[model samples]
Target chain A: MGLQNAINGIPLEWYLIVAAALFSIGLYGVLARKNAVAMLMGVELMLNSVNLNLLAFWRYLAPESAAGLAFAAFVFVVAAAETAVGLALIIAVYRSLKSVDPETLTQLKL
Target chain B: MTLQQVIFIILAIAVIGSALFVVTTSNLFRGALMLIVAFFGVAGFYVLLDNGLFAVAQVMIYIGAISILIIFSVMLTRGMQAMIPRNAQAGSVAIAAALLFLILLLAFGPFRLVVDLSGVPILSALFRTESARVLGGVPWQFANREVPETYIADFGRALVDLNQFLLPFLLVAFLVDAVLAGAIYIARQRKPAEVIAEREAIAKEEAEELAALQPQPTAPTLPQGAIASTADH
Candidate 1:
């Protein structure tokens, strides 16, 4: 209940709430932004929020286990790699159309 | 609230507010900038969770690398005048929002969170004692024997042993190289010479049309009173 007691300092549910808010915001960004690059940024934000939740749970529930740390590291690396490829694809799209608007990119239509 | 909890609340507010701003801003550049701030806030959360390494990595990667790359791509592809369109599927957005709200309720609404505040004091005590011993240059006692300072060396050597992360590290290198090659190939193929030629032809046609629209005078037209003035002279 006090600052001196680490056990009851901050509730785990608060972290969960923050994580949920972050995820929802990310979803809204993904839905609203038409630029492919912006969409990719939203996806990254979503992934980061998920990772935060995982790390928070790991630290609170099982601090002794190194698995959580390892998993978070893996997620970070994967996120970086995914963004690289995604941004490259976005660049390719821009080069072709001179614009990055998703609505105008309709060449795949039959 | 306790100081720790108070700090956490402030950080959570910063994180959530910046994330929302990043999502809702119409300017793509501003959104990217807000994303960097959001990343820093998240890293602060990481530090509060006692993960200093992760905090550093988050700042270095998300703030430094990923955000910069996104901003660069936005600038390269479109000028500042480009407007980001709003959501196209209102129905789908409403449905997704409903689902997200339900999930949040299910995940956090019913659970009571318990925090172990006493653990922090105990950890602080143990860390202080250990640090005092380390600073005093006293050898660590292990199995009733005084162990030398070479313990850290042994730990480091064991970490790099054949059964450890060597293979995964090398594999990551390979993956990065492959991604680089693929990106180069894709970039090269996106812009063909034919597209450039077509754009140039269109530009030339527009220029020619504008040139033809101008009045072509076979002889200079006299002013309204110029002929009368010459007759008077």
Candidate 2:
């Protein structure tokens, strides 16, 4: 079969390329998307792309060290906590202003 | 041109498309949904890279919790369906674009192809004995095995091992607890009167909508002689 080579089925650089592209796309979202909640979603995407880069390096190059894998695991916990607090704050803002637009809340009125 | 490469290409496209949709869409609800799809694609990438542990974690934490929380916020806020054109700050968009272009130039630059590939054993069978060095990383001496077999076990051991990662492990737990308490305290800081007032306002709004839905019942005229003769007749 021409499929399923045990090692090097794909190059490490390809993974990096894709990960970098994904990260850039996420950056576009973060800076461009107007809604605050969507902006947070963009942040999650960027964080995830970073984790992908870490894990790709670990799996392909440094299989012996657990450092990269451990770092990715830590990122998971941080992302979860961040989302919780971010969403809670968004809800609080919505309750006060009755809107979630990022432009309207320019001042620290709330 | 192997089957694995083919699969990787497809996944990369799916992931990029969904991620682009997540940011580009004006409908906030649709953006959240696209985010879920993008997260699933990332989990699939983890599976491709043989990190089943991270794949499960990705799905459980990102799709299970974060995406749902975002959708809930979108639903709770008004104007979820009404598409609003983003008031894109031109300066910020320009900055984000320039930053992305620089990163792409650095990453996909011409110099990357000239780098030596002698160290990685899995990909380079001809140079099995030599150590392979990638950018900014320690030279990896060829390990005895190819793909790691004990990933799940290794993760558990590394997580609990006192000398290695125990401190950060405990710190993460503490930080999560702090976030929980802080989120609750911060979100509930509204005064009691304000809370009651918001509740009443929401209730009144819903009641008005309900009233608008029902037709006013016309007054039924009493029977001229027999006050509405009988229930049976």
Candidate 3:
């Protein structure tokens, strides 16, 4: 019930393992989903996992320094911007092609 | 196991399971919802890591804004919800992802190389640690300390201080401004006639979907915003 015990009880490796699994799942989503929006969702998952890793490291190894938290914050902003631009591009693509499936939008295929 | 460990396990399971569902589901709408669940789990992790600020940020940013954008895109492209091939190389991709996970586990988990790779100059230089032994072959050699109460305030100062993250902060600010303007431009560039046509087509498609379903007495009403947007034509 001690605060220190609660904070440091969990091993850092657990966070890393969880992040790895999350990243892999996100990879599958990004590579396997044909829908552009679904792919974007996968990317978001990967970014979240990265944030988890950064923050976990910060907590376990370097809580005194603000480097990890600052990096994670930057990641948050980037993820937000990425989603906004990605969805906008998806919408534009759908408007032109009447679909969001990346497979059929092969106009750029050489 | 400690209470924190138990909570960690539960959070991890919830996150990974929902993430799996988000990736594998053919229904985009359902996937988006599950993605939000995964985000909530990650936010819980942030809280467990003793950083409540990020937990709130995770909920606000990921669940609030990003998930809404994803769901909106899902709705905007509705008819292709089901029956589309999820992917042609799904099996191969799954195998590849599993392999990648295994590799990551070996690197980050308990089953790591026994050799003291920290002796290598290159590895030592990368992690910026002196006399630090790599644990499980990962460059993780730092004594844990209790987080100071003023760490959040320190984080804010670090973000603005020129010697630290100010440059990146300003760059990100510029990036966000550009992204917002660009997104609005990209989404709004359609011709008036084209937009009207698409709205009508969506309405017609909804009617068709309803017709295909069992008849109901209640008619679907358009949103007031949709009505106003169309009226701008």
Q: Who wins the lDDT comparison?
A: 3
Score residue B189 of candidate 2 by CA lDDT.
Answer: 72
Best by DockQ: 3
True contacts kept of 1: 0.43
Candidate 3: TM-score?
A: 0.81
Candidate 3, residue A9: how far the Cα is off, in Å: 1.4
List lDDT for all candidates, in order: 0.70, 0.76, 0.87
- For candidate 1, write residues B62-171 as lDDT tens digits: 98888998888878776523664465773476468558855674546434222333346664465554353222133212122222334334433433455754565567
Model 2 steric clash total:
2
| Model 1 stretches astray by more than 4 angstroms | A1-8, B109-172, B188-233
DockQ for every model comes to 0.30, 0.40, 0.55
Selected candidate, larger lDDT, 1 vs 2: 2
**iRMSD (Å) of candidate 2?**
3.3
Better of 2 and 3 by lDDT: 3
Least well predicted 10-residue stretch by lDDT in candidate 1 chain B? B139-148
